[model samples]
Target: MEEILSQNEIDVLLSAITSGEMDAEELKKEEEEKKIRVYDFKRALRFSKDQIRSISRIHENYARMLTTFLSSQLRTYVHIGVESVDQVPYEEFIRSISSLTVLNIYSMSPLKGSMVIEINPNVAYALLDRILGGKGTSVTKTESLTEIEKILLNQIFEKATGTLKEAWSSLVDVSPVLEEFEENPQFIQMVAPNDTVVVVSMSAEIGEASGMINLCIPHTLLEPIIPKLSAHYWMDNTTDERDEEAFQKLSSNLQTTKVDVQAILGETRITINEFLKLGINDVVSLEQQIGDPLTLTINQEPKFYVQPGQLKKKIAVQILEEIEKGVNTHE
Candidate 1:
C-alpha cells in the first residue's frame, strides 16, 4: 500500500533543493506548523455563548435572592453569588460532584424535561444545623442523609423553588417543583450521558460554613424556550416602563380592595359568675366614660380613635383621629 518515489523522481527533488528552488528546512517547519483542532461529536456545544451569558445573568439574580432568603430564614449572615456558568456534557457534570451529596430533581413546568439542583454535603449539613438551632457548621466528612434530614431539606428547597421561578420570570413563566430526591449523582438519569447541559455554579457562604451549589439545566429542558433566552427578548421585556405599569396596576387593584373595620366602644372584665347571671335589661359599667372616644380597628389592628354618635336615627362612629404611628395601640 506504500508508494515509493522512483530514483529519477527523488533525483528531481534533490535537484530542486540544490537549485534553491525548495528549502528542506522550510518544508520541515511547514509540516510542524500545521494546526489540527480536535472536535468531539458527542461533546458538542448545544448552547451559544450569548445564551450562556444570558443564563448566567438569570442565575446571578437568583443567587442574590437565595442569599437573602437563607440569611433571613437561618438568622445568620449568608452570602451567595454566581461563580460560573458553563455548558458541558451531562456525564461530565455528574462526574465532577461527590458520589454522596444532596441531589434534588425538580421539574420546570411548561418545559418538557426536568432539571437538577446538586447541593454539596457540607452546605446541606450546615443549613440543617442552623435550622435545628445550632451554629452553622458542618462535619469534616459526610454521609447519606437520614429520613428526617431529607424531609427538612425538601421543605427548604421547596421554598427555594420560588426564587428560581422569579429569576426566570423575565424570560419565561416557569413553576419549578421538587419531584424527587437522590444522594448519588449517578442515580440521576434525567438526560443521557452524552446530552449537553448548562450548569450554573454558585458559591454560598452560610455563617461559618461555605460550599458550592450547582444547578444543572439539561439542554432538552431549555430547548422549548431557547428562543426566549435571546438578549433581545430579555431586553424588550425587562424594561422599567413595564415594571412601573405592573406596579400601577397593583396599586389600583389594592385601592379598591375592601377591608374589615370595627369600632370598639369600651372594654370591661367580668367574673364568670356575673357573666352567667347577666340579663338582657341589666346595664354593665364599661371602662370608658359616656363621652370617651372609642377605638376604631381595621383588619384587627387598632388604627384610629373615634366618637360614637347618631346620624339620621342610625348609630354610627365618626373617626376622630389616627392612632400614633409606630406605637402598638392594640394593648
Candidate 2:
C-alpha cells in the first residue's frame, strides 16, 4: 500500500523549493541515478573484457598454429602473434582497413551474418613474390594483383581459414569460408554503421618484413555464445573434467601404448651394380672395427650405442651408451 504525504510534509517540500534550499541540478542527478541504465539502441553491448580476453587466448593459439602452417606455405620462417582483441563500431572497423589491401568478408556457418578479415598488402605481396622464388621484400607500392597473385592468395586464404576453424574448435565448432573479396571497404554494407564488432588484430613477421592482419566479427553474432567466451569458462575448463572413469581409462591406455624400436649394426656404401652382383654368402665390408659398438635408432633417430650379442640364442644389442641428442625419451 502507498502512503500519502501529510499536509505538513508537502508544506516543508514547498518551502525548501521556494527558499532555493534544494538545487535543481542535484534533484535531476538524484532522479537520473534512480533510473536503470540508459542503453543506446544504435550500439549493442556484446563482449566484456573477460570475454574478449578469452577470445584473445584462442587467437593466441591460432597465431601459433598459423606460424607453423604459414611458414610452410610461404616456404620461409614466418611468425604470427596476436596484437589485440577489442570491440569497436562497424564504421571504425572500416576506417582501419587500408585503401587497397587483401580484405575479405567471410561467412561462419551457424552464425548470423558475415565477418571481415583483412591482410596488409605488404604481407600479401611478400608472400606472392616469395612463393614464386623471389626475395620477400617490403613492397609498399600498391599495384593491381596479377592473375597468378590472385591464385596464390586463394590458396593462402583457404589454408588460413582452415587454421582459424581449428583455433575456434575449443570454444565452438565453426566453418569459416571466404565469401567476398573487397578492394574498397567503404562501399560495403556488412552491418549497420553504428553496430559494434569485435576486432581480432594479429601481427605477422617473415625475416625482415612485418605486417598486420585483422578479423572483424559482428557483436550480434557473438552475443549468442557470449557465455562460452567468458574468462570463467576458460579458467574452469582445466579442472572441470567430471568423468573419472573415462579419465582413468585414458590414463591406462596411454600407459600401455606400444612403440617400435630398431637396432642398427653397421652401414656400408655400394653402387647398385655391385650390390646386385653380390651373393647371399658374400660378406660386405663396413668402415667400422670388429669390436666397435653398434648404433640403435628409434623413429629414424640415432639414440643409443649398443654392442651386438646373443642372449639365450636370440640376437640382440646390449646397451653400451645413450646419446643425448634429439628427443631423449629413453633417459
Candidate 3:
C-alpha cells in the first residue's frame, strides 16, 4: 500500500512540472508576439583632403577670373574664413546648403572706433561720382552725400548683386544683400559682432579716379549656410569618363617624351622682310652670338645647349648642360 501511494505522488508531481513548463513556453511566445520590431538606416557624406583642396582651388580661380572680367581698377582680394573647422559633420552640411548672401562695403571712417568693415571716404566718393557722371575730384568734404548720390549708390549695389547672382547661379544659389552702414552704429553692431568675416577688397582705377569696394561677410551669418555652401560648391559629380581617359592618354604621351619643348622658345617673331633679305653668303646675325652655346630645340623648345661635334662621319651635338630656363620658358 505504501509503495503504491509513493508511485502515485511521483506521477502527480511529474505531470505538474510538465504543465508549468508548457505554460512558461506559451508566455514567452506571447511576449515575443507582442514585441515591436524596429529597423534603422543611415547615410553619410564625406569629403577627402584632395576634394577640399580642389574646391578651394575652384573658388580661388572663380574669384580671380571674375575680378579680371570685371576689369576692376582696384586690386581685389578674396579671403575665406572658416570658424569651426572640425565641429560640424561634413556629410549633412554637404547636402543642405540653400542660399548665399554677399555684403559689399564701400567705405568706412579712418578712425577705428568699432570692429567693422573699413572703407576710405575717398573711395565712396569716387564710386558715387562715377555712377553719377560727376568728376571724382569734386567730392565735397561732408559726412553725408546728397539724396541722389545715395540712390545711385544703392543702384550700384543692386546691379553688382544681380551680376554676381547670374554668374554664380550654375555653381550655387547665391543672393546678394547690400547694406550701407555709414553712420548707423546699431546697424553695424547688428551685422558684425565678433563674427568670422570674409573681406573681398576690390580697388579700381577708372582713368585718373581711383576707388575701392570692400566686401565683408560675417561668420555668424554664414554659419548656418555652410552646409549649403559645401553641398553647392564642394560636391561636384560632373566628371566625364571619356574626358578623363583622353587626358590620361595625353599625359602618358607627354611623360614618355624624353624632352619637352614649349612655345616660349619660338615665340620671338621676326618680320618677313628680315627673312627675305637674308642670303646664304651674307652673314645674317641671330640673337645668339658666335661662341655662345647653341640651343638644341626639340618640338620647338630648347631642351639642351650643345657645341657641334663629330661622331665618325655623322655630325652630332654633345650636351653641355641642361637648360636652366624656367619650365614655362624655352632656353
Candidate 4:
C-alpha cells in the first residue's frame, strides 16, 4: 500500500518545481548517475597491482629457467611461458583446474604455511611418458597415476624446485621443499576457502602436448615478504652492496670451484691426413718458438701469457702477463 503524500509535502514539491528551486529531471538524472559496486568478501583482493606485477616478473624468469631445464631433461622442445598472474580465492583456484590433476603441496621455509603447484593431467602424463622411455606424447587416462609413476613425477618436481629457488632469490631466498602429492584437489586443505592466493598461470608445451601449470601461492605464506613484492622495494634492493653477506657467501663458494687450466705451447692447423699419420714422439712443428711465452688458457679461454720453466724438478709455467681482450694468443 503506497502512503499518500501530505498536503505540506505536495505543496513544497509543487512550489519547488514551479519556482525552479528543484528540477525533477535533474533529480532523476542524479539518481540514475549514482553507482553501487558490489563487493564479494570471499574474493577480496589481498595483493595490490604493484605486488602482482613483481610476482609476475619473478615467475617470468622462472618460466625461462624451467623451459631450459625441461628441454634438457625431456630431450624434446619444451616451451614454458607466463600466461597470466592473478589473485583469486583459494577455492576458486582449486576448482579452476582438473578434478584429478597432479597437486604438489610444498613448503616455503622461513615463511609460514604451504603452497601448491597444480599440473594439468595432460602435461604431467606427457612428461611421465618421456621419462619412462616413450615419446613425449600425452594420453587421456582417467585412472590415477600408479605408484611407480608417482615416484618418477616426484623426482621431476623435486628438481624443478631448484629453478623455483633461483627465480625467487632476487625477491626472497626461499627453499621450496615438496611435502606431499595429492591427486584430488579437495583432499588437500593448505589454505582456507576464503583465503586469497596469487596464482601464476603458466602455459607449458612439451613436445607436441600442451597444457597449463598453475602455481598457487597463499597470501599467508607471503605475508612476511609482502613488502618485498613491490616495484619500489625491488628497485631499492638491486644493488650488490645492499646484500654484502650474500656476495661474500658467493665469493667463498667460487673459491672452492675447480676450473681446468691448460698451458698451451702453441696452436697449428693440420689436415686430417697429418693428424691420422701422427705417431708417438712425432715432432709436429708448432707455431711457437723456444723461449717464447706460452698461452695459458683457463676453461678453454685464453687468459694469460706464461713462460715454461722447471720448478722443484717438475714442469711449471710462470705467469708473465695477463691477456687483454682481442689479443692474439699465438703471438
User: Evaluated with TM-score, which candidate comes out highest?
Assistant: 2
TM-score of each: 0.66, 0.69, 0.36, 0.68
Query: TM-score of the candidate numbered 1?
Result: 0.66
lDDT of 4 at 17: 98
Decreasing lDDT order of the candidates: 4, 1, 2, 3
Q: Which of candidates 2 and 4 reaches a greater TM-score?
A: 2
lDDT of prediction 2: 0.83
How would you encode candidate 1's per-residue C-alpha lDDT over 1-331 as one tens digit per residue?
9789999999999999999999999999887878656789888998888889889988999999999889888999899999999888999999999999989998899888999999988899999999999899987555577899899989999998989999888788998999999999888888889999999999988878999999999999999888988888877776646578888999999999999999987889999999999998999998987766888999998899899889999999898778987874445
Ranking by TM-score: 2, 4, 1, 3
Model 2: worst 10 consecutive residues (lDDT sum): 322-331
Off by over 4 Å in 1: 1-36, 239-331
lDDT for each residue of candidate 3 in 85-149, tens digit (9 for 90 to 100)? 21122222222221121123432122112212333455556556555554444254545555776
Off by over 4 Å in 3: 1-119, 134-140, 167-171, 177-186, 225-331
**In order, what lDDT does every prediction score?**
0.89, 0.83, 0.46, 0.91
Task: List clashing residue pairs in candidate 2.
Answer: none
Clashes of each: 0, 0, 8, 0
Give the better candidate number (2 or 4) by lDDT: 4
Q: Which candidate is the best by lDDT?
A: 4
